[model samples]
Every structure is written in C-alpha cells, then in structure tokens.
Target: MRFPHVRRGKAEEPPGIVGVARVDLRTKVLVRRLEPGDIAVIDHADLDRVSADELIACRVAAVVNAAKSVTGRYPNLGPRLLLEAGIPLIDDVGAEVLSRIADGATVRLDKDVLYNARDQVLAKGVLMTEETLDAAMEDANAGVPTQIDSFAANTLEFLRRERDMLTHGIDVPRLTTRMLDKHVLVVVRGYRYREDLRALRPYIREYRPVLLAVDAGADALLEAGYRPHVIIGDMDSVSDEALQVGAELVVHAYPDGRAPGMGRLRGLGLDGVSLPAPGTSEDVALLVADACGASLIAVVGTHWTLEEFLDKGRPGMASTFLTHLRVGSKLVNARGVHQLYQSRISGWALAALMIAAAVTIGVAIAYSPTGPILGNWISATWHTFAYWFTGLFK
Candidate 1:
C-alpha cells in the first residue's frame, strides 16, 4: 500500500529508529513490561510526567502514541522529557494503528511513518520536534487561567456532593491495624516519595506507626523494608506480589456501588473488601485513618500544590482539597515533617563530641587546684597497674 509522507517542513530527518512494538491500552500497565530498544505503542492523551518518566527509564527506542500528546490543557512535561532524553515521539497516530500492528512485531520508524518487516506502511503520525513542542507548551501556559477556573468549578461540585462524608466520617472497613489514638503514616506513590520515605526512616523506626500504603505505594513500602498494614486503592497500579503480601486490601468503589477492581482480586483468589467513596484512594486512606480515630495522620508523597493537582490530570482533586480540610488538625504532610524533624546524631559525631568534652574537663582540672591531686591519683593508679603487671610476670 502506498502511503503519502505528511512532512511539515524541510527539516533534517531523524536517525534510524527501529524496534519491536510493545502495545498496551494503558500506559501505566505497558510501562511495567517495557524494555530498552522496544517501541512503545500507547494510547495516552496529554501524557503525564510520571508515565513519561517511567517510559524514559525503560529506555524505549521510540514512542507511537495513538492520541494527542499535548492537548494544550496544561503544560505537561511528559513529551518534553521524552524528547530531552533523545527518544523520538510520534503523536496522534490514530487508534487504528494499534490494531494494524501486532505486538512483538519488528517495525521501523522512518521519519513520521511506521513500516513493518514486509515494508508496508502501517501508520503515519506527526513527529514532535523541539520547536513544535516549545510552541505547544507556550500555548498551554496561556490556557492556565481557563484550566484553573475549571478546576475551581469542579472542586465546588465535589464539595457539594461529598460534604457529609468528609465532615462526618466514612464507614471504614475493618482492618488488622488499630489506629486509635496512634500515629498513622499514609504513603502515596506521588512526587519524591522515595526520597521522603528515606528521610522518614528514623520516624518509622521510633514510632512504628501503622504503615498504610495507597496502591503502588505498597511496593514502595516493601522496597523500603517495611510491610504495609493496610493497602487501599483501585488496585490497578499495584502488583499482585504486593497484594499477596498479607496486607488488608480495601478496594475503592464508586459512590453508586460499582467495584471494577474486585474481579482482578477474585481472579487471583485474594480476599478484599470494597469501600464505596467519591474521591481518590489517597483521600479515602486519610478518611479511614481519621474514622479509626488516629491521633495524628502523617502523609507522604500526596499532591498539595496546584501544579501537582494539574499534573494528576483529574478534576477529582477537589475531593483531595476537601479531604485535607476534613482531616484538619490531624493531617500533617510528611514532607514538611521530614524537613523539620532532626534525625538522631550519627555514631561518629557522638564519639567526637565525647572526646571534646573529656579534653575540656582535663584542661579545667589542670588549671584548677585539683590538678596536683589528680596528678598524684593518676601516678598511684599507674604504679598499682605496674606492680600488678610485675607480679603476673614473676
């Protein structure tokens, strides 16, 4: 089949890029199995930074996205990161290409066209360039005011819907961990979570707070050498291995009582309970702690800033804002706590401090009238030790 080249301008062609196609409807799931030198076939719209970071870490040869990489909704950093990493990005290739191309099929990306081993053009897409991406980012920045207005509207709508649940309390599921009058650490797999977890090591060791992981945060906890006391989320991002680790699993269901993730758990023969809620899983986790009467709830890796909420690409963050307000006095962001709390002194520093104190004491003794008495005592002790040594020899 003959395919027309949709070249935009007279620009230099990108270098040879060829690899096996790894196709998945969900970018998050696809990233788990992606390897270096493989072309990722994804259907992600306005690809977020976290997904892009995962793709970059996989070292993919190129990305063939079936949807628009940037819709000018917000200045998402995903496409920019891929381009900065020297990875070719082909956007808006259409959903038909996903069917035309088979998984594990060796394909060559020549300019903006993709060809199979038989030299048949499978699909064509716009190859993103630095100039084009920069222009799109500028446009996205200009649209920030509109996005913020929309976000505020959504937040108000959420407040109206979930006011009672947030203010009163959620009917929390029974769990093995008792949070009553205790400190609870709720970890979410969001911004700088690993670094925050590293910093919280001393606190975790000292308090032994209930380790509550939200979705993939379970994996994060396990990696940090702590088992989760409760695992709550939609159960999509978390691994089956983490599910089987014996933590109580609570699936976040829609307000209308629909639980989609329960099928996956039943398929794996794992037991879990469903908790109907309107907000994100992290929000539900905080509510669960609050309902369980936790004295203090420390949060790690949860979104706080407006930019972070935008990065999430979801309007439901209005629920997050309300969740914070409801959990008020009890909720403390772990990021801030980590920054303020001073860690225990190291052994080397402690030893050096002790040495300094001993030297100061010795100097004070030498200058005071007690110097002669100390000198005589030291001499007598030395002679006694010397006599003991001589007697042993004899």
Candidate 2:
C-alpha cells in the first residue's frame, strides 16, 4: 500500500531528504559501510540501543526499517534514541522495500515515502517522531512482564543445561599470555565502549593490564593505540589486520565443539586455542580470566542492566547472567575502576604549574618599584650574552 508520486516530466524533484541508500537485513553489517548523510535501510525489529548508537555515530540522514521498529517488546530504546538524535526514522515498511530499493542507489525520502532517483515511490511507512515513540515506549513497558517471564524460562533452561560448567569451571585453553595475579582488562565492543576506554587511558598506562579483546573489541584496542594481549571470540567481526597482531587467539565455540573461528584462523595460516563453552564470548573471556587467576577483571562495553540484556536479544544472555554470578567477586566495570583508583599526577601538570608560577613571579617583579631598572638590566644581560655568543661563533 505505497503512495506513488506520479508527476511525469517534472521540472524539479520533490522536496525531501536525498541520499544514497545502504540496504541490509542486518543493521550491524549495514552500519560498517554507511557514510555520513547516507540513508540506512534495515530490517531490524525491536531495534536495540547498541544498533541505534552505531547508526547515530554514522550520522545517517534517515533510517527506513523494513520491520517494525518497536513491537511492544520490552520497551526497547532504539527508536527513541534515533528520534532524539534528530534522524528521521520510517518504520514498518514492508520487506519488499529491501528488493525495491537497490543498495548504493540515490534515493529521496519525503515525510513517509521513499522515492527512487526517477522520483518514483519505492516504499511507504509510518514516520517515527518523539511523540509517537513515547507512546510506543509506554505500551512497550506493559509488555516487560511477559519478556521477563520469557527471560526467566530461558535462564532456567540455560542453568539446567550448563550447571556443571558453571559450577565446576569452563575447560579454559592454555595460552602463552599470562594472567596469573595480574589485572585483566576484558574489552567488548558494547555500550559506550569508546568513552569508557578513553577515560581509562591513565589507568591502562599505569597498570598495563592484560588486554583481552572480544572479536571487534580487538580493533577498538588497536584504534586506541594498544596491542591486545589476547583475542577471543567467534571469528566473525574482527579484521584480518587484528588477527595478524601476534595476540594469542582463543576461538570460543559451541559446547558441541563446532569451532567456526578455527577454520578462519587456519585459512589465515594462524594457530589458535579452542574453548567450547555455553555462554557469550564476553562471558567466556571473563570466566577464563578468573579461572586463570586474574587479580581483578575490568570489563569495558559490557551489558549490565536488564534493558541492556534485553537489547542484546539473545537467549545466551542467560548464560551471561550465570557468568556474572560466578565472577562477581572480582569482576568490575571499567568505569568503576577508573572512578575508584585516582591516577597519579603527571609531569605535564607539574610543568604547567611551574610555568604559571614563573609567569606570575615575572609579572609581580615587572610591576614593582624597581620595574624599569630590572627590565633594562635584563635586556642588557640578554644583549651582552647574544653578542658574546656571536663573537665565539665568528
């Protein structure tokens, strides 16, 4: 049920937002290639906050979603985040939108309709605004109990299935990189990771903790000019350059021993250790560090709240819940570590203070009763020194 603008041989195109369309069913994959001012076409339902944050960072002109942005599913915060950022969001456009609008094709979006370069309508959807998103969020909040029930069921099922591993310990792989009694920084490419990592720079420089990166988190570390000591995850999002950085690779796999990352490592002629576990890569990373005798584990970009766990949209989140229970004694958020331990004063601060003191003293002396006399003497001393130095050079 799309409305087409059928004005033929128009002198000027319709007034609307114009940009190249980047279409993908997976929002995460699409965001990587999207440039600022491009229109993002995604099929994400109940769009999570993490995905919305990425889309916002890309500075997209508009978002056209093939699926409903919100389905009263646990009050997801993605649509609201987009609206707050002033990015136009068109919701519930049919899946046909993906096929109708070609990727990398120039398109124009009016209030609710998307038009191709020829000014023909491709798809139409409900435009999401602050008012509509707020109404949806309220209704969605009513559905949280159902989601919580589902979450509880999944958590119970996971606990039943993974009780032994959770109680005893994961069969961690051996590594050349040591963690015994050392502070371990487990970096995940999750919520506000960049800001938290930037804040932790002083702590990172001072402590020099073992950097454990999960998939794309390795790239984040490298971007911040730090080499990861260990990289662990399914081989999907991490780059080839990160793989070749000589970090000890640990391929986390299914408990049944299906290691997808191992094949990728082999293809690159690289060796890796495999640790098959029940939970997420982050969970496995934390547990592995604890088992290896880490003094403390500081995590960056980890999901901590119920909304965050729901945003993750995975049954494996139940395993992460259990993982938290197991590692609660020593586990701490990176922001928490940055807040608790005050970094020592730097030499730069000292130098700046010294310079300020010198300037204040000179100003006070220059305004004193002997100001003119001191100024003349200083000028004469400088002139004499310069002449003496020049004579020696001659």
Candidate 3:
C-alpha cells in the first residue's frame, strides 16, 4: 500500500461492464485481510516467489488474476483451485491494469463497496463483475498459444539485430581477436527457459554452438548441457561457478567507463574484454557475439513481452528494444531441435501408446456386464492398429 501508483475513482469511470478484466500480474497483497467479496488484483508472473503462502491460502468469494501461472504461459486451474474450494473465480486483469493502477490504490465497488488501503487505488472501476469472470476464462484458454508465438517471434527478431550490431563498426575496441568459426547460443534469464532448454538439450549439444551466457543465462546454459564460451554482463546474476568456468569474460561497461564485471573477473584471475555498450546484459552479450564474429547466434530464455520487463520492475524498456533491434536477423529459438525438434511421434512411440491404452480398455471391458470380452478385445486391438498406422511418420 506504501507503493506509488496513479489513482482513479469509480466516479471517474463508470462501474458496469466497461471492459474485460484480465489479470496477469501476481503480487503479494500488503493488506491485512481480503474481505469476503472484495476484488483483488494480482500481477506478478512468479506468484510462487512474489506471494506469501498465507495469501494464496486465503479463501475468498472470488479472485481476479494478472500474470501467467507457473504451468506455462497460460493461466492454469490455480485461481480455480480457490474457487473449487468455495471461492468464485473471476477475471484475469491483464497488463492493462498494471499500466493503469499502482500499489495501495483504493477503489469503490458499490454502496458498501469502498475497498480502501493505505495505498492509492490505481483501478478506477469495480473489481468483481460477471463480465470480468467471463473474460478471464476466455483469456486463460487463449494465453498459452499466444505466448508461444510471441516468444518465437521475439527470438527471431533478436537474432537479426545481433547480426546487424556486429557490423556497427567500432575501431577503438581492438583488445580481442574476432573469429566466426563457431556458432553462438545467446542466453538470457527467461522463465522456464532452462526447462525448455532441458527439453531441447540434446540438440544444443549436437550443434555445439559457442555458448555465450548473458549474466544468469550462464547458469542456465551449464544446466542444459553446454559449457559457456563467453560470459557477458555486468557481473550481477552470473553465478560464481559460471564466473570461473574457463570461458572468456566480457564486461559490459557503462558509457561512463565503469566496467563492473572487470573487477570480478580480475579477482577470479580470469581475463576479460570490456565493451562499452549501453543496454541490458542480453544486449551486451549479443554485441560481444557480433564483435567476435560469431557465426549463427541462437537465443534461448529471452524476454519477449513488455509485461515481462515490468515484472522485473525495470524503470525503462530501452535495453530490450535496443537488444532486439541489434540482434534481429540471426537468432532462432529452441525449436524441436531437441530429439523432438519438429519431429512427430514415430510409429513405435505411437504404437506403444496405443497398446498401453488398449490393455486398460480390455481390462475394463472384461468387467463390463454388457461387454462381449472377445469383441471388445478385437475392437481395442483394431484401434491400436489403426492409431499406429495413422500416426506413423513417413
């Protein structure tokens, strides 16, 4: 409630179904107790990290959400868990609200509907509404697929910018020799990118791209079966293990000539190159790859949405924009390049699944009073055959 956010009142904006409330931000409620019918806005993506277990344990009449749940880019049955426990599930108030409201903002519901806190109410309208609930369900259904496409497109744009930034031409920074024989994997600290990388690890080892970690991405790369070729950042999130991994270090210095990572590298007895680039760790990593003439820079676990940056509580979006613009042409996301990279299930895996299904069906049918065991077995076996036949990848 002590946090500052713009305030608007219900009188300022009408209370009916003015618009869809989609909650994507999930954060801890600083208030004492959420009343039975009071509508609350949750907006942090890592609710598990940001929210207290007690807040989640609260049984409310209804709840509105704002962030993607842990179950991928979609809203899982998490909010519904409370609802099924007797609380009603309401809308997912999307990024639009975060762009509008702030911490400790007071809002009015109806006659007895004044929801107040020490914080300024950033929301101008009523929280719980039938229209808002419907919108949350609709968004929950659509959020996952939309997120996947957005991730893919942002990755593509990042690669292209990287290629361009490399050729930007700086003659003063000749402290290192540049070569392009190896491929590059540009890493960023994105949510579940490590899992995504784990799912696709085999392919990464296959390509054997020069692993370039952008701060926290160094740990991610190591976890996903790759040694980093270079660690690039301001020495903030890159771990101690990642620091001395024998990878060449590049300290991204401020334009003011302060190289933060240099001191860390020096203490570790590691040599590092400094690049005076003004942007994010990811951006600096891309620039290093370009300057070194790294061929084919691929990206993983990168931030793709504006809301993502806001979740980090950053004051600006300049670094993200600049990084994308710099590495737009040459980046490809982790596709089915893992063993499953774009490959459909083989007849063997499908046949295995079908057989697994048929055995259970036969067991169930044998116990059915109306079932002809012989006929049921035959039908199930046929389905298994047909499924395998259709599922076979040519």
Task: Give the top-scoring candidate (lDDT).
Answer: 2
| CA deviation > 4 Å runs, candidate 3 | 1-181, 335-394
- Which of 1 and 2 is the better model by lDDT? 2
Model 3, TM vs. native: 0.46
lDDT of each: 0.88, 0.89, 0.56
Task: List where candidate 2 sits over 4 angstroms from the true fold.
Answer: 1-10, 336-352, 360-394
Backbone clashes for every candidate come to 0, 0, 44
Worst 10 residues of 3 by lDDT: 15-24
RMSD of each: 7.4, 5.0, 15.9
TM-score list, all predictions: 0.79, 0.85, 0.46
Per-residue lDDT over 236-261 for candidate 2, one digit per residue giving the tens place of the 0 to 100 score: 88888999999999999988899999
- Evaluate model 1: give its lDDT: 0.88
True-vs-predicted CA distance for residue 261, candidate 2, Å: 2.6
Query: Which should have the higher lDDT, number 2 or number 3?
Result: 2
Which parts of model 1 have CA positions greater than 4 angstroms off?
1-15, 336-394
